[model samples]
Target: MNSLLKVENLQMHYFTSKGAVRAIDDLSFELMRGETIGLVGESGCGKTSLGTSILRMPTPPGRYVSGKILVDGVDVIPLPEKEVRRNIRWQKISMVFQGAMNCLTPVYTIGRQMMETLNEHSDLSRSDAESLIAEYLGLVGLSPEIVQRYPHELSGGMKQRAVIATALFLKPEIIILDEPTTALDVIVQAQIINLLKKLKQQFSLSFIFITHDLALEAEISDRICVMYAGKIVELGSNAQIYGTQSPKHPYTERLLAATPRLFKKVEQLQFIPGTPPDLIAPPKGCRFSPRCNKAFDRCFQEEPPLIEIEPGHMSACWLHHRG
Candidate 1:
């Protein structure tokens, strides 16, 4: 499979009066063409930050500290801001932000906003851009006539579809969907998920699906990347992450235990105790050692590297590294 995106030792931090917040610390992953990699973690675990870093659009005070973001074999981290916006952002990769309801401007019609994106990125004529917008809107299961309506006139599901349609208008190879099904009814969420699968098959596109819901991730992802405290703790196939095989990372185990299972009878849903560590000054050795029940002296004294515990499965934990 062709490699579409490669993130290597990518460190993105936010500078403040107090100290630097290590939002993404030495994170590395490869995204193959026409593949879906699900990023699952609790909030503030750097799922969204990783997405923004790939697009080189980290919010103010948030800046790239080190490492490379290679999209299609070309490193984008060192590119100029203007060059990144013109050649990389939206052209190669685009993002569907967390809240679809809040993504659109109430004053602007859907067509107008989408048209602006086309105008900024490409040299498509007005008629051509409008036609493309309509085509994409229909592609996402929204009616062409819906493009004329304002955001305030659309339902939550409609708005979400519209946002997705806009992301497709750029003809990007990869899309980072940050909680795409969020804040919608169960039926609507299913509809959106179906639409995404259809689109992925029809276009041969790759996706980075970011969400806190593990079940939803299992439905769409070919592989799963589990993140904690601004780093990946485990990465493996969906079956390896959710199947009978025990997870290599303690965090991964606790996360699966916390999620309710439909097929299996549940006496109680277990939860991970304590909050995530502070990014500004996280623990010295293993960031999860403080909360991990299986922690030992080695876990608190030395950070573990992400190493393959089994074929095509990697985990960063002392448990996997112990002699």
Candidate 2:
């Protein structure tokens, strides 16, 4: 495989005042070059944590207990913070966080912030840096004048586009976008999604798109990974996971059932019945067993491993477990 990024047995945990929370538990996956992979899960299910951990930029209280994050076959997990900041981040991989408001510093002008990032990474003159930044902003449908505006001055969609532009300015091979269109209206969401699609092709980029909506994933991703309780329950091509009548995992099916389809008549949208398991004190068996319709006695007693049940599809569940 022409893998651009590979995460192996990744475990990221947060040591809160209460207890240790496993934000990412034994997660593993790969992103092929120029591929778009969607990560979908409910809130606090490690989607954001996984995305942050990919850049090795965990906040306080969070730590990478064990894992291998490789970019272009080079292991990044062992790199020092300085090395990661200088070489790995933004240069090889970058992230546009969930909230655009949080992404940009309100006090700083967009031009100054973008220039600082550009100059820090490359030894470019002020004029050269501004020129390059403007070029990138243009790629994301922003005008050069946006550089002079503060974060508060731009519209929500514009702020998101600016953040995306900053991410792509470094020309990174992989970019992780966490709910890029979360707060925008439907029309704006479509516009941003379209912009992303165009940029990906323009730069031959690979993307990890994280969102709560599976329907959105189906619209853009070549493959989608269903995350639950800090672990991926299923991973497959969009066709195998969504196009098929039966998804290998019950959790995946329930998610699809819960999604509201436009212009499609349905009496009611099915809802997944329970709250997600507490990460600080997660169940010992399958993390998703509590909500899985196909759960059996064994499922509640032992955790399932992610194993391939089809040519390119992998799922962790008792129904597909071969042991």
Q: Superposing every Cα of model 1 onto the true structure, what RMSD results? A: 1.1
TM-score of each model, in listed order = 0.98, 0.96
TM-score of 2: 0.96
Query: How accurate locally, in lDDT, is each candidate?
Result: 0.92, 0.89
Winning model by lDDT: 1
lDDT of 1: 0.92
- C-alpha lDDT of candidate 2 relative to the true structure: 0.89
Residues 193-225 of candidate 2 have per-residue lDDT tens digits of 999999999999999999999989988899999
lDDT per residue (tens digit) for residues 1-323 in model 1: 98999999999999988899999999999999999999999999999999989988898799999999999889998898899888888888999989966878889898898898888888999999889988998899889998789998998999999889888877789999999997999899999999999999998889999999998999999999999999999999998998988677899999988999889888888999999999999998999999999999998999999999999999999887668
Clash count for candidate 1 is 0
- Residue 58 alpha-carbon offset, candidate 2, angstroms: 1.4
Ten-residue segment with the worst summed lDDT in candidate 1?
A: 100-109
